[model samples]
Target: MNIEANNTVNPEVKVGGQTLRWERQTIEKLLLANVREQRAARRWRMFKTLLWMALLAALVWALVAQPTLPKTPHSTGIGAGHTAMVSIKGVIADDGESSAEYILPALRSALEDSDSKALILLINSPGGSPVQAGLINDEIRRLRQKHDKPIYAVVEETCASAAYYIASAADQIYVDKASIVGSIGVLMDGFGFVDTLDKLGVERRLMTAGANKGFLDPFSPQTEEQRQFAQVMLDQIHQQFISVVKQGRGERLKETPEMFSGLFWTGEQSLQLGLADAYGSVDSVARDVVKAENLVDYSTEENIAERLAKRFGAAVGAGAVNALRSLPPLR
Candidate 1:
């Protein structure tokens, strides 16, 4: 007997009960989706990395690179002869516009320039830090001797205290008739908040390892010993300042009783007292005294953007240091 075996085939014969065509298609779609997701993730990572790098580079450039300032067309108007000019205006504090840090470089450049006939410091300041003034004074003396170039100080509105201190180092100090000059002295000033704290019923708690760590704390009551020590220190600094003035001015100073008593005088009176050599303006000094009518400004001024950037960078660095520090603070 010839018998034919029954033939049967299930529709869902592939793995996971799917047809071969459907299984292959599903696998292809999954692979494509995975590839697309991987590509997008890679692109996002690359973008983020590049963005961070760009930000870091910008920050570095801002902090490290010197900010360029636009030179005015009239800045280089030293017509036939070269008369290098550096300005010392405002407070002469270590960090101020009239600080030695800014003035010294300009002075060096002016002195080093063979084309420069002379150097002039245009002064219009009420004075500030004696330390800064002393530094500039020393440098001016050295540069003058080295370069064999005469440096003159031409006072504008005022040149008192530290301003006068620096000007004393110049070969000659010229001033306007009404210019305020002198004030050869030193002072350490501060405010005491102990009474204010007592009125407010606020108690200050301070801890320190060193004995004199809270030496000049405003919240704490000062002892007689502390007061004496402070006075002694001030006296020493005052003597140092007096010595410098004497050394710089020599016999030119009239040696008045109030000269070193923090007393200021007019430019005309300064000439009589030998504090100033003559009465002249910048133009007059450059033309008549220096014999070079042309004036070339070498003064460096920081723009607002540069100042802000520097302050921001300094603040960021200080904040980082302060965050890591756990030392006792002075009140």
Candidate 2:
């Protein structure tokens, strides 16, 4: 007896002259692909969640570990004798660690405390913004007068330009024998890329609403009027610096041809010129001059976590502005 094949019950596929079951193979492949896709999606979600959690943890840690200002060294809270010390290191800018923002607060704290007999500014700087230095200088003088407490500036490596501007306001300026001392002048500086652009056959395209809006543009050809204007401004600022030095040093400054010619000198030469008073360190000034042996630092500094957070936050900004090649010159 011969039986007919059941086509409805079993589907078949012929491959290379060999019959194969089609339905089971198709179902198995589809199931495997779906499982793989699901697993990949789950893994991606887990990764995203972990990244967010890590960021949250870092934020929490930074907020919790806020930096604390250093305390003074008086045994009795409001006692008779202690020297207040504030560090003035690095470039002095409006937003920097060694600027009027931090220095004035430390000065005020030192002055307001009854136990603080005197304030000592320990300086090691190549100078920076004149405006910031002037603000700090003015505040120091005002505080000194108000509290009747002496404030001394002790130079370590360098005290030039704006740093000297600040130091000149102090009651006394002390320094190490090898320290670099003065730069009492102002200048507006820039590079001229007009020649370079001309050589490269590149034309500059700059537009401004105001006549002098792009005053110090390096790519543009410098005009005589602009040069004169800049010179006048620098001369005015230089005169102001000279006047300040004269006021601070009084008759002690020896008049010389190149004294205020934007020149620096050794600490010994500075003492000779009355730019500085004596050879001394922070320790010596605190011990011998202030008569308070204990030294406490009142320098404002960003902790590691805060710096990292700032870098992280500014990463996008940095990347966005990386292509901006043209920037204004500095004074």
Candidate 3:
């Protein structure tokens, strides 16, 4: 009587004839309990695995996705078999690829790397920011002196304006014969809306803390004094560009009258002008110079969505933390 019942009727479930029996209800209850226990255990294990997987994913992202300044490497670790190259592409702005943030780290890495036989800079830009270009040029010279490694600049399709300015600092600048180069001049461009504003019956009531503070404002008319002052500034910057080109190119620069007149030149013309060392590409540098034959670009890949998400999340989290912290001390 394993069955729990008040009735006299037998609870035995006999299958075949010979009174073979077991308490049916009790067995069914036990089986259901065991099934529930197994299901619950399986669910717990699955949950644990999911938790561990999530933790591992977070750890991997932290280690691989984040961009940090590379530490300088020892000479022996870099040169004999390895070569590190950096690509300078896009607009050379303060925050972009040609910017200090993007370039300085790579330059520092190359300078410190002992095993890197050659530090190659792949140039493909129309050029921007003379100051940024000059800074990068100074760094290239410093790095070259410190590391004593040859730095090569390879112009892909175009290396005009500030791009050429930066490339001139390289030990050898190579370009494709059809590549665009030159445009070594400073320029200032702005629009004047004073006449348009008068037509639109609007007034620009601008006040300046200093007499020349708003000298170049587009809303104001250009005065002779302002024009002269602006020329002085442009000349100062242009002189800097000229000085760098002279310093970097030495006797290599074959500047005709048009070379610094803000006009670009074809790759062959650049070579003729001594603006470039040779008319070849990265393959030439690698195969002919460093003898690496193969190249690897270790630049950190940027993910816009991930960066935005992280920034937004961090801002929100920081706000919450600050709000909590700012509240009067919790009793």
Candidate 4:
């Protein structure tokens, strides 16, 4: 029995077939999952892009198309006979809310209104720029003469420095007994950083086109000549302030050594010194003094659009600064 049995296993066995099918199914599932993940990532990127685009659009709209609220009849000076009120409620600066740009228009509107019996300046501020206050004072006098309307100043909380400068223009000024009423003085304030910089080992390098251009620089020591020059300028302005107060108050002002010495006084003390007329309020003055019980505010109010535009501008400015800081430094 010369029978040679050759034992051979088939190449395409059932076990091998099963293993190949399993690997194929796993690869198909992995490919499907990868596609889904890519789609999700793309969608998220698109959403973020759209969100940024919307924010940019809104900022642009706020900047370009600053919409304002519709004026009511009272604001337009078209109402019944009333006491016209204009507010002076903050620092009197050229760029401030209490600036002449805003205040003058409201004053003119109030004075021009035929139905408005009288004009009242509702004042509550610690004062600021003398130049701005002077402008307002001049305008107040001119408008009072032109319109033949009685204008009164009703002080609240404070009526000092540049604020008193404006109040002086009024026919009469009323105040609360406890109100702070005067600081008839001018000042130029600053800080000296030369000593601090010396201690910190920092050098101040400044260039100016003119001699006095850098005279006010804090890092540089101020010359005696500069100091005297500044004092003279201040004195001249002080004289002007004194002259204005004298002219406004006339015989009503009782001259005292401390009166124009930059000393402030209480409303009661101011009354004694002729700085204020009497104790009264806006309502009382309107009802009793002007005899116009109705009140109409003719003040220029900051609108919502302006506020939003300002905030948006600030945000954009901050974002720009951050982006600049994050950039790679130049070689």
Each model's C-alpha lDDT?
0.83, 0.84, 0.80, 0.87
Best candidate, lDDT: 4
Summarize candidate 1's per-residue lDDT along 70-175 as a digit string, tens digits: 2334334345477889999999987777888788878887777666788999999998988899899999999999989899999999998889889988889998
TM-scores, each model vs. reference: 0.73, 0.79, 0.72, 0.77
Weakest 10 consecutive residues, lDDT, candidate 3? 12-21
Q: What is the lDDT of residue 115 in candidate 1?
A: 66
Clashes of 3: 5
Give the winner by lDDT: 2 or 3.
2
lDDT against true structure, model 2: 0.84
TM-score of 4: 0.77
Residue 292 Cα positional deviation in candidate 4, in Å, after optimal superposition: 0.9
Which parts of model 2 have CA positions greater than 4 angstroms off?
A: 1-52, 64-79, 312-331
- Which runs of model 1 end up more than 4 angstroms from their true locations? 1-80, 318-331
Expressed as tens digits, the lDDT of each residue in 40-93 for candidate 2 is 999999999999788768777866766534343333364576787888999989
Q: Which tens-of-lDDT digit does each residue in 220-322 have in candidate 3? A: 8888998998899999998888888888889988768887788998988888899888876777788878888656564433445445556667989999999
Between candidates 3 and 4, which one is better according to lDDT?
A: 4
After superposition, the stretches of candidate 4 with alpha carbons farther than 4 Å from their true spots are 1-80, 311-331
| Candidates ranked by lDDT | 4, 2, 1, 3
107: Cα error in model 4, Å: 0.5
